[model samples]
Target: MKAVLERKSEEALNNNSSIWRNKQFLLLIWGTSVSNLTFSIFTMALPIMIYELTRSAFAMGTMRAIEFLPNLLLAVFIGVLVDRFNRKKVLLSSVGLQMVMILTIIVLLLTSQLQLWHLYVLGFILYTSAYMFGNAYHSVLPLIVDKEQLTSANSVISFLYTFVGLIGPALAGMVLLVLNNIYGLTITAFGLLVLLLFISLLKLPFIKKEEDQKKTSMIEEMKEGWYSLIENKELWNLTIMVLLSNITSAATLSVFIFFALDVMNVIETKLGIILASTAIGGLVAATVAKKMTRWFTRGQLFIWSLAIQSLGYFLLFFSLDWYWLVAGMFCNGLSGGLMNIHYFTLRQETTPNHLLGRVAGTSSMLMKLAVPFAFFGVGALAEFIPVHFIFLGSAIGTALIIVYLIRTPVVYMR
Candidate 1:
């Protein structure tokens, strides 16, 4: 009795203390920052590599379309797996799988056997693993931190990653210009290796399951997740809102590489600068996100963020020069950064820790349902329409989504 009481007392104290003092949380952030840095670099390099290989805007869109398929197909099952199994092990395994895929990519590159098809297949596997890691990682955060600290914890994590983003793209550009895609990817592989080490050292508390409860089947578990999501009016509505928003984002982003290379006539280094500009907005959002919450409800933030994003897209629509495109990218990143912190915090705060994996997976699956088609459609359209028109279309779509959101009870949510 005394030991249990003392432990509880200690935990409460830790929970109330500063987030930086939490060793496990810090470790998680450090590891994730390294991985995000590499992923950012990979993101910059992959499109250029694909473009160089195929030189078709539609091909890049095809790659983007393929990347989201796993989310649509496998996320629900992966959610069940995360909730039932050890989350740390799931995270580690997912990271390891991605590393293997990256290594395979490196091998193909070195041997001069890399093909567009190879990227299509490997990218699917890699992103599937990334989805698994994301589910487990989201589930793990609630386990490690207190409820009151969620927003702040999320803010800190976002800030670090955005900071990484601020530099990672520019660095990737320089790396690509000077060395080659292989060297940039080699850095990514190394960061993942280091991430494995950090994750291994994390000592997460085990979740206690009720012994009297009967074991549920996987199908039943998935249904529970689905119900949990749809049953929540705010979450379900926001999920729909995000679904629309993602489509617009996908459409614009699908042809951005082409916009840079063909339309703007920029080289790798300048392209990186434009891409990295988004991170500056992200950095600003991360810095101010928590403070802004005190002044506005979460719902207000959502609407405003979407509004800002719409403005950003409109900027892109009129961007006759690279700097104008840079401005648009910054707004897009800023809105994304602002919304993500609140979005994740709200989900974690509302869902039971046990259901976090399932809910996250299902919601993600739902949000991603239309993205692949959007990618394909946008890719096809890029061949006919000017890229700026896609941005114009996306901006209009986002405005309509905002109108839809304004009519919902979502605006009333705190």
Candidate 2:
């Protein structure tokens, strides 16, 4: 009788349109907005700072590789941990660890004792926590919202992210002008502190697993996640598409600072403005993403999104001016915003509650498997090859994958 009542209650919430009023949802979005805004500043500044410090492209590339290495090495295991542990504990612990890393970086920077190796080790740990937090973050949403509202909830989150992207670079650029990396990261540390408070206030719904399932070993749990991911054709195909696209993106983005600093000869402020302008496209796409999924079949939207990104890469490849590069980033942002909304919604809607952590982890690991290699290789190759050529290769690679997806009939598009 209690189970029936709970089901009816959930159904009512699903049918209603007051997701905006959801206290847990609102807190999560607001807190995320703060952290993302600050992190955007840190991301834009880090590569430039490294280049200024070491003057070595290889070092920069290595740092980028280190940042994402956790996605490949630890994401799956951490996903299992998120599934097995209390989510609130996971969120607080991850954010807390991230704050510590940021504070450490800031201290080193101020003392003029910061080194490349410090960035490497600290970056690895920070992003590892980030990935853990990310898995737990995504896993928690389904618990708080109705299944039917997944798209709406994810769209809202994506919009906040895109909105931050739109403004974050410019803000970071301004902060860089008045302050420095140390000051910028000070803001990030403060934001994480606030994020911890909001996380502590969350009252997530409880999920009960079967006694047998709970008793399974971690290895068995991981295998269960891998099998669950492969069993869903649409989800598996989407994961492959993202995986390939990330490789192309990594190739272009990893060297873009060199492209901008050397080829474009733009200053930091201008570069920030250029990157921030690109987010306009994403912001627009985020607003319309839910409607787009409804207007187009899931497969159709996926194709269109990737096509837009490929076009953006072509623009970058042929860029005659900074404006052209901005146009390229705009396309990338638009497609990314669209793809992520549907992709996340599908994952949330399709996967079982008990396995959300593991599946999210496994899928993320698979998506990022090639990224560190791409970053390191591009960094090494940039020493001999022109950065613009890398852009061309990315465009070509992206175009080929789109064709492959279209031609492959075994993968269902609808």
Candidate 3:
């Protein structure tokens, strides 16, 4: 009992130390918060826009597939660029490009001249820019805080993400309604808010990479990054785990709207509420993740959270009612939030600083490579098989991953 009490005291003290009190960390969090909110709103709004405009699930799925295409194609190269150049500049350029894309989208929508293809092109551009910025942001995080506070810092970031998710989707639905009522002012408003976020982010200091012993060609840099995974058995194992997790998540997300509208017979407004419930659950989980990490090993947390997520998916298969669907989504969100915090901290702590960007990008590419497959497969399956079976398959696949993790020691690394 005394030892447990002492350990808690130590953790509390560490959390309150000067490292956590840094102004930069606060600024980073605020900047990321703004970006996250805007991005989430854009994500939720885009699918609605596509669905409304084309009224085709295949079209929506195709657009989503395009959005992920950049992750599969450009991630590794972008990671190489991030490592070779200044990360801050890479981030700024990406944000600036995103702003341009959003502005173009708003203009097209306002002019009543927007076509489906226009959205496709803009969505691709936006996601490409997002991929670049995301890689830099993830890579730079470990540099901002001490190793001991990594889980706590990651938890706070994940908490902000969940908070944004909770607000952004509902706000997006509201904004769309407002736009319909006010004759397109809401899109302008959203664009202006995004511009403000980009402006505020300019105040952040540029993060400089530590000098390396040898600078190499772009191909060499990429090769070095690839070598980190190939040479380290532990990283390789974790990379595969992340890949499988992403597949399950993408499969579930791709078919979610179908399940909500068809199987559950939910209204759009209620759909937003259901999605928000998941975010609320995610917010709660993220808030407690730091505390939970003290009691459970990161591996233990990941495996258990995944198992819970699989159960959530299984529940979705059994329950076609609105309330049950919402409950399952909520549980899935909780597990996802915890898994994100744990996995991100693990990556930051274990990866070398010089290779951070490349490593992150490579990992992202690997994980997201399965997304297009999920999008296409879900769309294909929905035409023939019942949507419930898709959920069942996803649950079974996730359970298999958990079993694989249980047999492996991948999560035991610090």
What TM-score, computed on C-alpha atoms, does each candidate reach? 0.84, 0.84, 0.82
lDDT, candidate 2, 64-168, per-residue tens: 767767888898899899989889899999999999999998899889898888888888899999989999999988877776677888988988887887678
Q: Judging by TM-score against the true structure, name the best candidate.
A: 2
- The sequence of per-residue lDDT tens digits that candidate 3 reaches over residues 168-252 is 7667677666665123334534543564465355433343344544566888889888887566666667678878888887788
Q: Each candidate: RMSD to true structure?
A: 3.9, 3.7, 5.9
lDDT scores for all predictions?
0.87, 0.84, 0.75
Better of 2 and 3 by TM-score: 2
> In terms of TM-score, how similar is model 3 to the real structure?
0.82
The digit string of per-residue lDDT tens for model 1 on 1-414 reads 344335533764665577887778888999988988888778888888899899999999888777777788899999999888889999899999999999999999999999999999999999999889989998888777766778888989888977986777777878778978888899899989988999999877755654545699999999999999888888888889889999999999989888888888978888878888888888888889889988999899999999999999999888888888899999999998988898889899888767889999999988888887797899999889787899999999999999999999889998
Q: Measured by C-alpha RMSD in angstroms, how accurate is candidate 3?
A: 5.9
lDDT of 3 at 313: 90
Q: What range of 10 consecutive residues in model 3 has the weakest lDDT sum? A: 180-189
Between the candidate structures 2 and 3, which one is better when assessed by lDDT?
2
- Model 3 residue 273 distance off true place after TM-score fit, in angstroms: 4.0
Off by over 4 Å in 1: 1-12, 39-64, 103-123, 173-187, 210-213, 255-273, 318-323, 379-389
lDDT of model 3 at position 255: 87
Order of candidate numbers by lDDT, starting with the best: 1, 2, 3
Candidate 3 segments exceeding 4 Å error: 1-20, 39-61, 105-118, 179-214, 264-270, 382-386
Clashing pairs in 3: none
